[model samples]
Target: MVEQLSLLAGEREVDDTAADIADPCEESGTSVSPMLPPAPLNGLSPSLERKRLQAYLALLVGDVAILLAAFYTVSILYFGTLSNWAMLEGGMISAYVILPLYLTVALYNGTYSRRSLTEWQTSAFRAATALVIAAALVNLLAFFAKSNAEFSRMVFALGLASTAVLMTAMRIAVSRALIRKWGPTSLNKMVLLAGGPKLNLPHALHVNASEHGLEPALDDPRALDRLSKYLRNMDEVIVSCRSEDRAAWAQVLKGSGIHGEVTHQLPHEIGAIGVVHYDAAGVSALKVSSGQLGIRARVAKRLFDATVSGLVLLIAAPLMLAVALLIKLEDGGPVFFVQKRVGRGNRFFAILKFRSMRESDDNGAQSTSLEDDRVTRIGRFIRRTSIDELPQLINVLKGDMSLVGPRPHALGSKAGSKLFWEVDRNYWQRHGLRPGITGLAQVRGHRGATDTETQLSNRLLADLEYMQRWSLWQDIAILAATLRVITHERAF
Candidate 1:
């Protein structure tokens, strides 16, 4: 049955029928063979990712052809040199100069990308902008090199103007032609549905789990291998299973190395957790969370954190040095205190802060009281102004924390009479992201101490909300808001 599945990867394009997947899972099930051997589907088209790359390359080549054709044709019309050696040399030099600049700008502006192929209007504008910028750059480079005199100014101007016009026209024509060829999307994705009830989806391939001896048991490597085989080259693999089976299928999808979804039951079956249709997939699904931040978002966030932290440290070095002197003079103790706190992925890290409390043999997780004698004279002043927290900028630089995220907590930290996590099971979920120096909760005056359940709940709620609606802009807003709440009433 598993061998039969891989054989179907190259079969037909997007043929969907029924999806009446079968049977509850059990460990060590009997192997079931396919009734008929799958056809040897050897003539498979390229994967969607490859197809997009190929399309982008083709568009790039087309742009080059168009530019050459337009420029040389314009040169012939302008200089009446269909075969002139002077025109040939000039064209070659111009091509060498303009082609690299134009292609670089076009790639940056998304002129030869999927968006260009999909939405021709944006592509047209982007293509025109790239050409204009490239032309300006070439002229600028020539000016600096003192070589502008060698080129024909009128012919150059005419060629650039004509090429820009031709490029835009060609892109529009190509995009429209693409739409007719591949419907709405650039690539008609082939989707395979695993173990679903009857669906009105005729554009997908359906499989019966039990009949094919497929199970969503993680421990069953054979079953997982079979499912993986079935999903090879599939753009999307949707698992429609009973409620008890959904979790297993979701795990399978995570390891399947393909975009996947698990179907949700009707509203009546799930209760309270409302079931609604997703127009994009034309089905109701749980849309399992793969990640909170995508690659671009993560990169932007890391850059922001590093840049801000580095600058802040540089600007605050003198102030920090003075604080360190005060800290050392206070009791002749360590200038910085390192506490074990839970960070991203529930891992423990040493958080750095200006020593704000007297050195003692007690557990470091103990929260200080308003008038705790353990806080030294200098510690009191620094804690009140939140200056003790400045050293955490080092943590941000070290990549153990972000500029704005849920603040990390000590392992023994408590809310009222109970441990922080004990107050709410979701307390651990906030650790999915790196901890921060200041966060939405801190900006909103939820800092200092978690003295009550409501206080902890509010912070947890804010952290979760921040995660759900996270963005670099939001982090910036949180940082801006932090300034106003730096010296809060509960700081000490």
Candidate 2:
């Protein structure tokens, strides 16, 4: 497993065959037109998805019911009689708290996932873990809230233990029953072949790579959309391509929202993140990208963005209001500027900024110079002070952007004589992350005008580097470093 594939794989390959394989983790450094976001492809098979949803819903109901029954039963038994309503209600408060907590934890831990339908042991284990965590949290809350005295310790222990045992047993039984009803492998997938060996993937769609538009060109959107159409209703894609083409297919599959695997023969040559052996098929395949960010990382990043943006907005509200008034007073134009910028996944999003340039036909056709005539008196100060970017905090809050990542450019923005994308094909790959208000490029003094290709290329490299090494700590560090440059000479 190459855990550091994203960072280390960018170095030059030792041979020509290896040269064809561009590291999916790094920029390919080639030029092509920007790729379009693929149309929605999944959920094409309503039956499988509908069944999964129904199964999840049923599990949710079953969990709530079991929790209610176990707690009430334990309460009645502890009281020695059902008629003593007041005493029986002792466990109800803790039970109410425990229910929501358990459900929340279970949802995140894959307790209600499609895997739970076939893997009884895993379902039971996750359910038990969620239950234990929920109980611990309730105990902590009770301690902090000074409500521990209201509930009996013995009942809490008995109720939690009994519930855990019941949930585990119930999951095991339900999972087995579901497996019996659904097939052993309830997944939909597509299989591609290599010349030497034949694969016996009976339940999967056998696809021709060329026919389905699987090209080595990330620059082509039509090909990607066609490939996405073929992958619709599929959970996984296992392809047998030459080692050189693996990286390209990996990127395509990653963008398609499908789990991708490339069958490997020369393991030593490929820098795979991990290798999955299909013992039944007698072949090993490389695991493709786990995604630009995992679900947990995404959730954490989102929470961080919301918290920081919300607080910053609160502190800067008065200042924003003052800027708005000044912009309006200056030219009676709109205080805020909204422009459609290419965002994550190559989707268009309206980025908010305080108007810095004069109201003209400017559509990012040119870079803002240090002393452009288009700048109004208030605009120049705000631009130079980086105050013009404050409104993007709203973009972060609205989930259209991030606090740290690649800074999105205008569609018409260029590097020297060419457009940004034309300057480097890797330009589109930077959109793998949400555009940021402050990024590695900005912190490294790569801001302001991009009068030459080298400037955009350098910034692009930093953007790619940031994505490769992305983490909460790094984001915090980049954000802290950003404070040093808010008034830098390059802010223009």
Candidate 3:
């Protein structure tokens, strides 16, 4: 049956018509082979399993110790001594109540999972979030227990802050120690691949698998016993076969008692943003999103843009006025340059900037060089300092741009002789969000003239990455980084 399934899978790869493949079970008089044997019960002995349990226990103990230390330190600092009557009472209550609650929350959030342990950043974020939630819950518990009087608000705040810092430090220290002892490559969980020999896996799959500590083993479908032995240590099984053989592989993996997934080779350029499964009429279908933010996120982003941009413009009004006067005095041209630039939804809007160039009829597509004769003396200083971009705050306030997004491109903009859209098919996708005064690409030193295809591609990738991973915190971080980016040698 395994051989028959493999043959049909191979034929399905070549033949486009699904009706051409025949089921071996239907053709024969015999019933389909019974499900593959269950996986071995004793893959690891009792002693080895005990050691794994001990490691987890040790981690829990270390966390408790760290929390205790944080509470004591905060109590001592705030009350001048741990012996303070109030401090001692608060410490005891926290030890008996808050710490256990925090630990429970962390566990529920999967902060201590093997995957989380290996990826310290993800674990740290989860820990922080859990701690925050736990703090809120603990406060409510104190109120309900009528024990709020026993704790000092100052001490509670200090403890929470110190605990977050100390816990993060502990996680980092332990992760580093683990990496050193196991060697980074040794820490990855194992994965098993099942499919015919002809399956073509992409090079990136192997690279990413190794990086994520997924040690992959390719198994022969005929050797069920050997495959079951391999499954004992595997964290997951990925079936990489044609659709026709999916059922057989599913059965084999199901009885193996391991989590499984099905996938096929994908083009290098296509990235998986997210996956959604839904029913279309009576048929089920899977959809892959290509980095589009939902409506709620869009609304939140606009609100954030409006609030931040308004505050910035209010504070910088005087500076903007001074710059406008200088620009007009330098060349007596328009105080602001209003040029049509492509924005979100592939629409055009007039992008505002303090006029920094001499009056000219030059086409906007013409690339500006550092030594361009059109730049006024004042223009050099403002452009170098990035003050010329300040007027775009108006555009943000007008809902024509965002404070942090892909920078809008001028119409007819080209990388060398080719238009930007012609340089890459995905170029226009950058317009999925409103263009910004500053963006991920700009902060990464991709701010200069994109005169080559490679430069444009690099900027496009950065834009796509930012869009795919957008968060309010990320935007604020990028805005802060913009200060440093403006002084970069390439900013001019």
Candidate 4:
């Protein structure tokens, strides 16, 4: 008989403690809290959350309604007059046959990840895939029931297209509003590691933390003997200086009995049960490879940014002009305010904004908050509505920004500054494409002051998601969602 014992790894405890000490007070001279309770998703802000729920409900109800409507329309065209009872009967049977298939495929591919819905092309492709799958299932059922001739293939096709369009648009609208309301923030799973300094472990870990949502706390090889107490908190462990510390590594793993998946930089090969070799930041190491976004995804993502930004700038020109004038009349200053922002590849570009602050309030490269004294009355209003960002349409047009990508940051942003990349190697991975005027993060309600590293990591994850699966229609859908977010004053 095997007895199950639960022990927290001591190595993880050291890592957590080190993370506390390693944090530098970057914003407002206060130490941001690292221990964040799980975010409350139950009563997420009612505006988008409620709307999203309603939209889902509406999809199911509207799906049934549309099926009925289509049947009636077809019945009238094919057989002249039809009774209400006949329409209801036809609609019920069709809906029962089709809706289950639709729901299964819709849920399977995550058609409902709010941020994913904003990319229209992606949504449409998903919609097409779901419909095709549903149709196949429906056809099989039709054959089994021997009622293949009862329903017209054309009606099914038309109904599927209409429902897909309706549901996609509804979801896109709801997701956009939610993101803007929430502002590109999420709670992420982070593992902190403690290892020796000889392997330059801290620097490599910091890089992974900034880009891949992995943060390293502190490294003390001596602490390994007490690993049993902290193993649960850690998803992966990195051992530093494989050459000199071979004995220490074995002692730590053996004493803890915490064997599953392990990673390390070893001087000699020990042939662990499940380990792979790779170079991290020019350092030789055996790291358990966790897949990151790929190169082809990066290229397709750039193409997505270019096309959507071009189309949106063209279509939204007149409204953008009105916003520009509104800013000028309120402040009597330059209509557009340009400032240096860090883009993909550590490149710098002037990000455009509608000048939401007073001209005299230039306080270096500081982020403005709701309580900032520098914001003019009009500035506050525009900022809240996110109209102040309208000038960025030009950035998109000029190829400095995308219609949908990660939101660009000032060169000195506190969350992940330009210096962050210099210190943390993986930070540059975010610059795989042009920045976006509105992105997966921005719509999810992450804006203004980001006082925590966890928040920054969350935003980075959303950006990477967009990169991994990008499309032009997705950009257009994001732009539309952006408009809704701005109008509703979700961001401040």
Q: What is the lDDT of candidate 1?
A: 0.68
- In the range 323-431, model 3's lDDT, one tens digit per residue, is 8888888767888877867665444467888777785332367777878888888877888888889999889999889999998887557788877767875665576
Query: What is the TM-score of each predicted model, taking all chains together?
Result: 0.51, 0.63, 0.45, 0.39
Clashing pairs in 3: 188-213
What's the lDDT for residue 82 in model 3? 50
In candidate 1, what are the lDDT values of residues 1-492, reduced to their tens digit? Answer: 011222132333222221232211221254335442221121122345555666778788988997887777776787777668776567556666788899999887778666678677888898888888988898999999999977777767877788878877877787887776555555323233444544334334555555444576554333443444445445555666777788767655654434566777563354435343444544576654344564346668989999999999999999999999998987899998887676664445679899988864222356777988888898888888889999999999998899999998875677888877667655655765788999999988898877889999999999989988999999999999998987878976
Computed on alpha carbons, the lDDT of every model, listed in order, comes to: 0.68, 0.72, 0.61, 0.51
lDDT by residue for model 2 (79-118), tens: 7888878887876777888999999999899998878877
Which residue pairs in model 2 clash with each other?
30-425
CA shift at 201, candidate 1, in angstroms? 26
Task: List runs of model 2 lying over 4 Å from the truth.
Answer: 1-72, 82-114, 128-161, 169-216, 219-247, 251-259, 262-285, 307-318, 332-336, 359-365, 412-428, 451-454
- Candidate 4 lDDT, tens digit per residue, 32-77? 3454211111111122333444544555565457555655565455
Q: Score candidate 4 by TM-score against the native.
A: 0.39
- Which candidate ranks first by lDDT, i.e. highest? 2
Instruction: Give the winner by TM-score.
Output: 2
Cα lDDT of candidate 3 equals 0.61
Q: Report the lDDT of model 3 for residue 197.
A: 23
